[model samples]
Target chain A: MSVEPLDPSTLPEHDNLPGNAHAYCVRLTGPLFVQTGRMIAHYPAGGGTIRFEPLTATSLGTLVAERFSSPLYSRDWVVANGQGHVLLGDRGYDINSYDLDEGNLTVRAANLLAFDAGLELKESIVPGFLTLIGTGRFLASSSGPVIFVEPPVRVDPEALVGWADCPAPALHFDAGWMGHFLGAARGALFGTRSGEERQYDFTGAGTVLLQSSERLREDPHALRRLEGEVRQLGPGALQQLQAVVQQQLAEHQQQQR
Target chain B: MSWRLRTPRVLVVDLDGSRGSAVRARTGSMVACEGEVSFKDAGIGGGGGLRAALKQRVAGESLPLMEVSGRGSVHLAVEAGHVLLLELAGEVLRVESESLLCLSEGLRTDVAFTGLRGASSGQGLFTTSVTGHGRVALLSLGGPPIALRVTPRTPLVVDPDAYVGCLGEVRQSFVTDVSWRAVVGESSGEAFSLRFEGSGTVFVQPEERR
Candidate 1:
């Protein structure tokens, strides 16, 4: 049998759909910043309309410039303005809303679904994270319900969703792996990896968010970040990068063939 | 003798070799069975006759079905998608062909034009409409299906990729935010959304169709 159909009046203001953790509903009273392609559906209030405007929209320039400070993510976000109940789902992941009261949080860029206009967003020092500063609510999704762990914890890079009130995590390579890598011969370039040699070491106050699953969805922003960093290389470095890319492409083609 | 859900994703239909107990299910959806059973092709039009077949071919909403009849219980599943069972009481169910898993013997399937709305969502310009009184099992990808209610006062706008189908009386139209930036190829992903007005119930999945 089908579940009871939810209307705007019955829908929660900011919560996951009843009996379903993957879908979220947001009652849009003011402008909300949402990631591209995350909105699944929306119900408009009578006599009002909702518009999803890109960050570059002139009408939203002042609000966006004041709240959004990440140029690398400008193309990946939009401003949803109007009166309505907006529905958002991300790859069937479990979505949860977090409230910040004059606090700050840094989330993996890909896991972030949407945030409030009052929250100031900045790119974290970490390459693939965004920090939200101020008092507001934000939505994020993970492969499963997020597990909160205190600092002095080491998490797999793939399972680490984000951290709150914690300093930037340090890259921790397994001691055995480091020793083996340094002791191995040159031909070991094709190193055998268990995919667990790297971890994020959290060693300060605050909580860390971890998903139950270690499966990572491909993040388009990660590729864009890499492309952005490529421009900083000198000519010699660029040539070496080109050679490396070609080698990787040749190996991929060989494997496919 | 009866239809039972083995799980939210698995459907078990029992047949007693009676004409009334037979079922038409999507081809290749049979994952397991017990006792003696026989499977026969449901033909090109999915047992809706030649007109339905022709319309389906033109609309690109073809459903390849196989009729199962025998003294045995059969298990049905597709693509590991979540299955939802809906019983029709003379009301119409408009659904995507790919999402239809199985139908009891008394239902009739036809094609209905969905206009330019499908072009953007990649679901095609037509949807499969099921009428009559029977049980229908629908499949949803990614996660559990979400049902939303619509009224004259509260119209629903949806991303086409997340739309599964609708029940009762509902009218759908294409909504596009056509600005100069769209022409310049810098438009947001929400450039095209589907608006549903009138009174009815709409179903969407937790993930968009890629």
Candidate 2:
């Protein structure tokens, strides 16, 4: 309950606020890539300014092209430049910073708060996650404290945050559930999912990141990714997808009723 | 009698009827009360009379308050938010109307213009200002409030959604530069941030207002 106000000089570089786990303070010397809207506050250096410019800004075109490689996430990230201490938060999640010295790590896009410009960011082939390569530090948030686990494990899709030095996980379906789905009576194939029947199986040598809670945060980039994938569908496939969406809308309306 | 924090989210006000002790609190914030206590509306103007009422109407910074008095202690809370108690010693405490939970009888609440800075923060154009010597309770959303110290050398910039309030001599203004441009498809969410100069303390919450 004792809150000693912190100034730039006293604030830690890349650490959670004292007595608070939901907010983090980062001392900025050069440029840092930050997720849009995650910045809570910042203290500029004496007579200095910390400018938050979009990745699309012309002044940052060359720098962004060099450090940032994810097109789907360009709109969701900004380049923070100048000298100062910046505080970042994400919906009150637990914030943690990880340093990668000539290593790589992949993390969920929505959970990543910011990363140093020294690291290069690339789009992970596994869809909603982004891969950070080279070296430097990055900040990410989780619904609860992150739990580290070795490979040769299975994790709930909703609880899986990201994995490091591991191959993308393969979708694993419970044997009993698969038997039920493959049975002659396929009527319950889509409607009778208990949600626990599916998990991500990791068999390689690497570490997996998992949140204590199974609650999932709504990802803003998910829709855009789906939109990008839709461009590859044929005309007939597009019509069938529309019909499926209409059916989903009808079912959703019925549930509301 | 004064304010005692029962928990981070709960506040209890000890009142003595014989001493004519009373407090003005946000309407619908009382959770429980012991002994003989009564609640009364703080009138149309929220205690500052006709002029304040007109300003509140125009500024959309309406504060609906209720006066609590009697022989017992009253428990107060709102939206399950964390409570921050402050002892005001005559310095003006400018805060959001919605964040105000309780105020001592001696303090006065009024509306003040905050210019375009408030507009981008989604706090409208006016903010509620409290003055006088008394106890004040503020409600912070998401988590415990963080107090940042500002001086002549270091200026602070804050996202409007995360800003709670400020005390002392601080000047707030909106900065809309090329960096404030909205992305191609997305709204960029943080189009601008409130910049504070001079020497003062600024308070911010851990979570932004959605």
Best by TM-score: 1
lDDT of 1 by residue, A1-257 (tens): 45788998899988888888889999997899998779999987876888888887737899899999998888878888889899999888899999999999999888899999989999998878899999999999998899999999999887878999989999998888888888888679457577888888999899999998745656656777889899999999999999999999999999999
Interface DockQ of candidate 1: 0.60
- Total clashes in model 1, counting residue pairs 3 or more apart in sequence or in different chains: 0
Give candidate 2 regions above 4 Å deviation.
A214-217, A252-257, B18-20, B117-121
* Per-model B-chain TM-score: 0.91, 0.91
Model 1: per-residue Cα lDDT over B121-161, one tens digit each = 34636888999999998887777888899889989988878
- For model 1 the interface RMSD, in Å, equals 2.3
Runs in model 1 lying further than 4 Å from the true structure: B117-121, B179-188
In Å, residue A163's CA in model 1 sits off its true spot by 0.4
Interface RMSD of each: 2.3, 1.5
Over the stretch A30-93, how does candidate 2's per-residue lDDT look in tens digits? 8899998899999888787888888887467788899999888888888998888999998878
- Pairs that clash in candidate 1: none
Q: Which candidate gets the maximum lDDT versus the true structure?
A: 1
